[model samples]
Target: MTSANPHRPIRGGAAPAAHATLPARGGVGLKPEHFRHILDTRPDIGFFEVHAENYMVAGGPFHHYLERIRADTPLSIHGVGLSIGGEGPLDEAHLDRLAALLARYRPESFSEHLAWSSHGGAFLNDLLPAPYHAGTLARVCAHIDRVQERLGRRMLLENPATYVEFEASTMAETDFISEVVGRTGCGLLLDVNNAYVACVNHGRDARAYLRALPLTAVGEIHLAGHAHDVDAAGAPLLIDSHGAPVAEAVWDLYAYAITLAGPQPTLIERDNDLPAFPVLAAEARQAEIVMARQAALEAA
Candidate 1:
């Protein structure tokens, strides 16, 4: 008999945290602009994801809405400030706040980017890329181990959208991510937009990149839009700007990814140029259609 998710075999020695998994359906990032609409209509979104830092506060309108929305929907807490690839030690205070937030909501999944954002006692507003050599790999694995140990839950590590590569790196990005999951027992948050953006920027094949990932361990998927530009050499460059609609190219890549990984909980992410609730909801439904087609093909 074939396993449903052949690539998701248990790794590492410890058991994963006992949390319910998100349904293999479509979702969207929960934005304040759509909160009231979501509550009033109760859309058919499979799940809702929020940035962990946004709810680390004591109380606010965000929490007020989130608490109510979380009651009926599966929640995904994605952290943007964890700096999992930084050379310094993991931030204990931030980890504590994250733990509290997860405890409160008991989200179906928790994820953070593989990039680092803080250095030398300073926090940056952007997710920065890391070199993929042995030294950096070891550091990343250690950080993820610390996170899983402290949070008492398996966390997903997302691939970063990079504009440049480090010459000192000895391993591929996919290889590095695979090693992290293998060593830490964490899962992968396969960001299709990130995969496409980074591949287009680095002159690699996007499909090849997807095939290289440890897809079976993917707990969730992210689909966002990117801004286009030219490099110093006048070649095409792509930025992972979550301000626009998902590009047609990204949608194609997403379809390919769905076929490879089977249907998973996919999220349509938009953080800028906020649109009405209906527009985002439409896109989320579009993802569902794509997944449904894949399922039909597999069953045939």
Candidate 2:
């Protein structure tokens, strides 16, 4: 995959002068169920990520453990409710809260989805997709600009796992994302599982889809499992459920992605069917082994 538009640059802003950075290794989503275990055991993982909304409060146990765990290990703050693709202007109040959260943690990396989840003062619980065209492109870029300016750091925009496409979209998803990154100077959070799921759902080649992305801008990679089924027309339909373990097919795609983007800060995300801490830690270790193998191949 040749570089697509090499003019990508990190935008300037009043972001914090000093913040932690994610190492090019493997990480796991920080879950409350494993908080105590993590504190006691302190697993040898690269980093731990948590949803920004979970720690919006002034004080609580979440902060208690996170404050400690963060001190020892690198942290990545992932936001899911910013609704960056909304048709409306960015929410100032929500931005204010997000700004405060970032200030407190000063995570190494921060990211959000390329999907919308709110409208007309009502919030949707899920990450929704938007049409890829000039209008939506402008909106997404504007939203990202506001977020980077507010947070004072370059944000990574994760590609969405889509089950549907819009006829109104005049541009391909990859083109739209490239334009947004080139315009706003934000990084790309390459979710390998989402890429595979979207490609399979839309009958596109997964490897080709990965090749079209702005791989050079990928600061991190996400690996997750999906629920499989068939669409109304009996075609393969994969849901970004994030419930099961990383599938073998997705692992293969992850290796391919590493070959293109090099060893990124990969995260094994399992949001449902909660497993033991060791289970997640083992997955994180497996990701590390994969990254090491790919690195060795490049060396050879």
Candidate 3:
């Protein structure tokens, strides 16, 4: 896909320097269940990421422990309810809350989904998809600009795993993502599992989709678990369900993705069916092995 504005210089809002503090090593989604274990063991995790909305409360055990954890390790704030892709004007109140959270913690990285999750003041509690068209494109870019301008920091936008496609879409998913990056100067949270899931569901080539994306804008990578079910037509469907272990297929795709994008701040996300800290750390080790191979390949 051609860039939206080739002549326009890409902005540093999503630049690597914005995340220089976050190592290219692996991290896990910070969960309440593992809070004590993490603090006790102080595992060799590169960083810890959390859902920004979860910590929006002013004072609580979550805040208490996060303070201690932040003192020891780098943190990345991932926002799930920004509704950046929503058609309505960006929610000012929500933005203010997020800005306050960032100011309080000063995480190494902050990210939100490209999907919307709210309509009219009512929250859907799900990351809803948006059609990829010129009109929708303009709306998303403007929302991202406002997010950066209001928060006073560059944020990464993640590609959502979609089960449906819009007839209104005039561009491929990769092209749509690249257009967003080119227009907003935002970095991408390249979710390899999501790309594989969307490709399998849409009968598209996953590797081709990965190869086509603007890898230079990717400051981070995500590996997650998925479920295999059938669509309405009974065709095989891969759901982006982060309930189980990372699928081997997604891991293979991740290995290839990192080879192209080089080492990134890889994250292993398992929001459901939470596993033991050791199990998650073992998966992270697998990611480290892949990076090790990349180091060897580049050296050769």
Off by over 4 Å in 3: 1-19
TM-score, cand. 2 vs. native: 0.94
Clashing pairs in 1: none
Residue 187 of model 1, lDDT score: 91
Residue 146, candidate 3: alpha-carbon lDDT:
83
Model 3, span 3-63: residue lDDT tens: 4322233444434444455788988888989989988998998888999999999798999
TM-score of 3: 0.94
Question: Against the correct fold, how does model 1 do in TM-score?
Answer: 0.95
Instruction: Give Cα distance to truth, residue 25, candidate 1, Å.
Output: 1.1
Model 2 lDDT tens row, 222-241 = 99999999999999999999
Worst lDDT run of 10 residues, candidate 3, spans 1-10
Measured by C-alpha RMSD in angstroms, how accurate is candidate 1?
Answer: 4.4
Model 2's C-alpha root-mean-square deviation from the true structure amounts to 4.0
Candidate 2, residue 231: lDDT = 99
Residue pairs in collision within model 2: 15-152, 20-108
